[model samples]
Target: MTLNTRIEAAIDGALGRATAGSVPPKLAAALYHAVKPGGARIRPTISLSVALACGDDRPALADAAASAIELIHCASLVHDDMPCFDDAAIRRGKPSVHAKYGEALALLAGDSLIVLGFDVLGVAALENPARAGRLVGEMARFTGMPHGICAGQGWESEATIDLATYHRAKTGALFTAATRMGALAAGEDPEPWTELGARIGEAFQVADDLLDALQPEAVTGKPAGQDARLARPSAVTELGVAGAIKRLEDILSGAIASIPACPGEAMLAEMVRATAARLTPAHTATAAE
Candidate 1:
């Protein structure tokens, strides 16, 4: 009934179907563990929110798109926590998939989720062929080589780094997909919504960077100081704590301003403001020190 309830149900249902069948028991179990007790469900919520704000023509399409984005996000996390990358032991307040399932199964489970994400998208596209094609293109660009999140991950190994490029791919790509798919779900042009998604995406990354800098494992539900530990490029690393907070505020304001006029504009604005406020460094200062 409520938006949050609907989104959670859809995500759970999708994850259920994704793990069904004769999946290797080990990997399937790993997949289940990886996606269970989902986090803020922000990506899907943002997608659906944009759709509702635009016009609630196709709630199903919005759900499908949201589920797909979340699947991809979860998959990325599974791989990100592998021994090669962050080598994190915990996520979502529990031992990570790799920790529970072993590296081989964890890798397979992450790959499976990536494929399943596209499968969810395909199902969504079946209902609206034209829009589905557009969504596929958008998602592919977001996940594929050269410019997608994959590229964003690869950037870490490079000698010189571009923080904007890394952030855009690592986080902004999905935000772009969420808003664009939301627009398409409402039978609207996605171009107009792109800037809003980009801003929110950047803001989300900035918040994440800030969290890495200031939040603790108890509040964040993930290992803290990862950015500094991994020496990963981050806004906070480039800009001090206060400067990063200022940048996050600027992005959040820009995101709210980018929404033209829509039925759910006010609600969307509230969500952005609330999220930004929650991520403020001042709120998490205790954790930082």
Candidate 2:
């Protein structure tokens, strides 16, 4: 099967299993709604790409890692769009979970997805017990305390925020998990892939900042002007529009260069370039300038 299909199927299967047992009807439906018709599927794709590059001997483990990363991402989006946060009405080009279901159900769905992420990994562990521990540890480190996405969100609540730390945690963390977990799933040394993931994550965030600044909600599929609205730190705000674009290009360049030698190096580089192009905000900054 194609990479996208594999990722979606894995996610669907995981969600199905998690909700099949005694979950409340509304909560279970919300969980499915939160993840369906996923946007980009970038994290899981990256995980699978890295795994393929490094000899994906265990497809099931790689799929589980990818799905787990995406579940966390979707859960974060649901919470981020709540009334307490962005209060966005749309997500993935449709009504957000909080909009369709009540705020309570949306919150519960996000919480459920978080637990399900680890559960997916647990199921994958059955095949190879040794790698399971490391894979789960890497994901948790990126998903929780210290320098995880939670820390990234916490920075927003503080009087002042560190841009690098915030960006790394909120966005770069999952990319790091994607690469490292992909390597771990393939029985390869994950350390070498770390910088590549970090660079890619940083690039993606910068690109997102540009999109938030330059694109409309219709095109971006989420609220525009969020950083400005929320008084959140953004690369485009910190660096000017042109400067953020330059930074994105620089980071993507570094990401491509940082790819550790693997059989699929050329293909991976192409994928990064294509993703960079796709991620560039619809309008050139000159127009906004």
Candidate 3:
């Protein structure tokens, strides 16, 4: 199967097995709904890519780590789209969890997914205790308050913030986790892989910011202009369109350079270049026009 297809199948399978049995029917349905159908699956693909680059002996471990990362991402989306947060009515090209399942269930579903992410990671770690411990610690550090995505989300409430700090927490944290955890899952030292993820994560966030400024709801699958509307600090707001694209290119170049020569280096490089190109100003012109 293609890389994307493999990642999708792994995610679907993990979500299915996770939500099965003992979980309340309503909550299970909500969890499933949170991760349905399609997404770029970029985070998990990054995890799997890094794992393959290190070694492919434990695809299952990599899959578990990727699934856990995705669940956290999906859960974040559920909460982010709630009336309390972005108050967005749509997400992933459809009615958001709160819009479809009501505020209470949506909240619970997000909570459930967050807990499920830890659970999945716990199981993965058990099979390889030391590596698993490292993965858990990295994930916790990336997801917890004051330094992680949760803190990134919390930044919206702050009156003052910098673009780098904000984007690092909001988007880069999970991407960092995806790459690091993938390395850990493959029994590789995660330190070497950190820069690769950080660069890519920064690039991804810049692209996302550019998209928010230039793309439409139909294309982005989420409310566009929400960043500007909310006064959220973003690369586009801080650096304009052309400037943001330049920043993205610089970051992508750094990410490619960080990838060591390995079997999967080409694939990872391609993914980074493709992602960066997708974020360039020219690509946004058609969407803007």
Each candidate's clash count: 0, 0, 0
State the lDDT of candidate 3 residue by residue for 1-289, as single tens digits.
6667767777677677777778778777777788887587788878888888888677778887888888888989999898878998888898888988889999999988888788877877777677667777888898888788999989878788776787788889999898888888888888888888888898888888888998879988888899889877788888888787778778889999998666788888887777666556465755433
Q: Which of the numbered candidates is closest to the native, going by highest TM-score? A: 2
lDDT for each candidate structure: 0.83, 0.90, 0.82
lDDT of 3 at 82: 88
Q: Candidate 1: where are CA atoms >4 Å away?
A: 285-289
Best by lDDT: 2
Model 1, C-alpha of 56: deviation from truth (Å): 1.9
Name the better of 1 and 2 by lDDT.
Answer: 2
lDDT of 1 by residue, 45-80 (tens): 788888888886878877877788888889999999
- Extract clashing residue pairs from model 2: none
Model 3: how far residue 35 lies from native, Å = 0.4
- After best superposition, candidate 1 residue 124: deviation in angstroms? 2.1
Candidate 3 Cα misplacement greater than 4 A, ranges: 278-282, 285-289
TM-score, ranked from best to worst: 2, 1, 3
Among all windows of ten consecutive residues in candidate 2, which has the lowest summed lDDT? Answer: 280-289
Q: Give the runs in model 2 whose Cα sits over 4 Å from its true position.
A: 281-289
TM-score, predicted candidate 1 vs. hidden true structure = 0.93
Model 1 per-residue lDDT at 216: 74
Candidate 1 local distance difference test against the native: 0.83
